[model samples]
Target: MDDKKIVRAWIAYDWANSAFATTIMAAVMPIYFISVAGGTDGSWSFTQTAAAIVVALLSPLLGAIADHSGKKVLFLRVFTVIGAAASVGLAFVGPGDMWLASIIVVIGMVGFGAGNTFYDALLNDITSPEQREKVSSLGYAMGYLGGGLLLAVNLGMILGWESLGLPDKTAASQISFVSVGIWWFVFSLPLFKKIKDPQSTNKSRIGEHLKIGVQRLGETFSRLKKYPELLKFMVAYWFFFDGINTIIVMAASYGTTIGIEETDLITALLITQFIGFPATMLFGKLADRLGSKKMLYSSLVTYLIIVLLGYFMTSSLHFYLLACLVGLVQGGSQATSRAIFSKLIPPGKTAEFNGFLSFTSRFFSFGGPLVFGLVKLISDSSRIALLAVAFFFLMGILLLTFVNLAKGEKEAVQP
Candidate 1:
């Protein structure tokens, strides 16, 4: 395949499906979670945290299975369909039916999270050894652009529901969830059409997939001793990503808690999506020139600054500024991390390794939301809750120093 064409299609995957993240998950859902759940109380945050844990626990196991089975594209499609259906179903949940809405959000989020197992696995298939950074960044850039684009349309749908025949605020809000299905399904069709699934060598039975997935997972973990650098990288990615994930999952929630209106949160998140677009492009080129480690360090420094600033942000403007700062580094840091890991994963185990990797990410993700909720419970301060994330980042950065990026690169290219 021509590099340009594949890369374009790869990036399009980001563009097409990212609206699910920008509008449904990041922007609108926090408000919906609050409004539909009846309150923004500590209890609601706790429930959100609980959902995170459930997904976290299951996500890696699923990823491991996908990797061993080489079902990246297939799994991505399955989860996308599930998530899309649930999202549309949310449109039917009346505001008075808050409990039903929460259940639906959890189902949709889990499906979304589960599908990512395969999405991340596709990294190796789409990009060559030499182009992972650039390719990864392109994906993120597309996501930012795609996410922002959908949010704009979603915003219109949200604000002009009267003309659209929505009966009330709850109905209008429900439409946002419905848009997630429409947008995700419509955009996702392209990838299913264009991208090829990595062919699995594992021709085992369904029972065998489960058995081998479990067996190989243990083998991979045991390989940590022989491959300490890869293990270290996994640990590093997990810790820093935990902090990063916390910010992503909680940014809007914290903003709303701090008196920023729903619209302001939407605008701020839009900044994250669009700003993230070019930043990813820039980071990709820079990583190609400077090495992934150096580029990643720069990203962490930016994240540290953003989180530190969050400690003192007082108003919606402060939230806006924080969102911009986050947007600048968010996609770059994350996409680069994926690229770096792709360079280290054991070859032929793209799905399995990526699955294990994603599992760790999901597990840590569970912690962040749950911990943020706990912090909010104890302190009632959004800033205080967010500050704790910095600690996770610090731990990751420290572990990163022990991992040899060059060795990972060499190993990743092995047949």
Candidate 2:
């Protein structure tokens, strides 16, 4: 495959998948889960934690299987279809159907989370190490643009529902779920058609593949000490990345809880999406000059500041300001972390290692929201809950200080 085509196809998947992140995960769904379904913020957080735990348990095994069989694309397709279908199903849910909504959300979350492992692994196939940081940032930039575009349309749909002949905002919101599913499916076609997979001769029967997958997973776990730097990086990622994920997942809900209007929350999300595009690209360039580690540290510091600001946030204006700050650092931190991890794993083991990375990340991710929910329940203050999340970023920064990036990169280059 041509390098440019491969990179474009890979990045296109981000464009496809991010609609789910923006609409379903970050924007509309949480609000719907709360207002329409009569569910509490804690309930929403627990549901997400439940889904993450399931995906965390399954990611390493599934990743190992795909690596052994060279069927990363196959797994990606399966999960994408599952997630998109579940997203479409969400449109049919009515008021007082929280149970049904939670079930569908879990299925969709599983598909989205598991599919990302294979997508991340594909970084090794699509880009040279020297290009990974830039390419990764490009993917995130495209994600922000694509996701932002669809969200812009969705927001208009909700705000202008009466003019559009819709009954109410509720109807518009429900239809937006269906639009996201269609958008995700339509945009994913290029990735399916354009990207080529690496070849493998290990095409065993399904039962044999399962057996080997389990064995390899066990072996990977046992050999963690052999890659101490990678292990340390995973630990740091668990803390900080969990904090990032928690913010993405909870920001809208937190805004709503603090008496910010839904329109304001959605508009702020739009700002984050559009601003994130250029910020992510700029981080790509900076990563090449300042080093990915330094860029990542800068992002972490910014996030810490965002968290502190969240505690003092009162009006829509504060929310908008914090949202822009989040946009500036969100893609930079995540893309740089991904590029750094890609440099630590062995070439052929990308899927398996990325799976392990997802496992640790998602497992710890469960705690952030859970803790946020617990804090909110105890204090009756979303402000305090938001402030508590800062501890994760602080611990992540501390642990990251232990990683030796030079040694990790050298180990990855070895046979």
Candidate 3:
């Protein structure tokens, strides 16, 4: 495939999967889990924490195997199928099915997280170094647009179900799950068709590959001291990205706790999605001109402000304002982090290193939401929990200051 086609196919996967992120993770499913399943806010957080731990344990092994076998695309397809299938299964869940719902959600989230490790590794295969920031940003921008578009239609279905001939809001929400699954599968075709695999000489049998993957993962950990800058960046990413993930996953539930209406919460999320599309693209251009690290720092500072805003939020309007603020920096921060990490990975080890990236991000990510839930449980205030998340951003900023991007890039280029 041509470079243009490959890049577009790669970006298309973001569009394909982000429906899951927006609909299942951020908007619809959390509310459904609460209203229909009788789950509390802490239960939602715990569900994500449980799923994150499972993915964190498996990603490195799977990533290393894919790298060794040169089957990254195969792994991507397998996990995407798992996620989409589970998403479809969610539509069948009914009232008081919390256990079933939680199990399906965990399966779906594991797929999403695991599939993303390979998708991110593909950045190294598909784009030149100079083009990575823009390409990565474009993927995220497309994600915002795709997710927002579906959420808008889903929102209409929920709000106007009577006119649409649906039975009730619950039925409408269930149908939205099926829509996201279909959207994910249909949009994923382009990437499956267009993106070619990177060539590799290591063609071991499955059993051998598993053993080798474990060995390689162990070696990578033992050699971490040699890549100090990359290690620092990963630690920094783990801290702030945990806070970011917690916010994305917990925002809807938190809104419910604070008396924000469901419609308003979904509307605020939709607004964030649309705003994020263009804002992410703008950040891409800015990163190209100003450097990824500088843009990342700016985003961290904005996140700190957003966390502070979340602490004081009371009305739906305040929720909307905070959502907009999150939109401004969320994609920028994540996209630049991916682009920067791409520059640091060792040659022929993109998937393996990305697995470690996923592992660190996910393992440490268990902290933010777990802490948030604990704080909420102890203090009986989601407000205090929001305030507690600010510490993550602050710690991330401090760790980021110590990372030498130049040194990391230099290490990556060495033979």
Highest lDDT, which number?
3
Q: By the lDDT metric, which is better: model 2 or model 3? A: 3
Which stretches of candidate 3 lie above 4 Å from their native place? 38-42, 199-203, 373-381
Tens-digit lDDT string for candidate 2 (94-200): 89889899999999999899999999998888788899999999999999999999988888998899999999888999999999888888888888888756677
> Order the candidates by TM-score, highest first — what do you get?
3, 2, 1
lDDT score for residue 307 of model 3 = 82
Q: Superposing all C-alpha atoms, what RMSD in Å does each candidate have to the true structure? A: 2.7, 2.0, 2.0
lDDT of 2: 0.90
| Steric overlap count per candidate | 4, 0, 0
State how far residue 6 of model 2 sits from its true place (Å): 1.3
Tens digits of lDDT, candidate 1, 1-415: 3367656766776786687777666667666767775646465556566666767666666666777677778888888898889889887875566677677777887777777667877878877778888888988998899889888877887788788887766677777778778888887876787787656566788788788778877887777566567888988888888888888767766776778887787788788888988888998999999988988888888888888998888888888888888888889998888888887877767767776776667666666777777897899877888887788878877888888888866765555
For lDDT, candidate 1 versus 3, the one ahead is 3
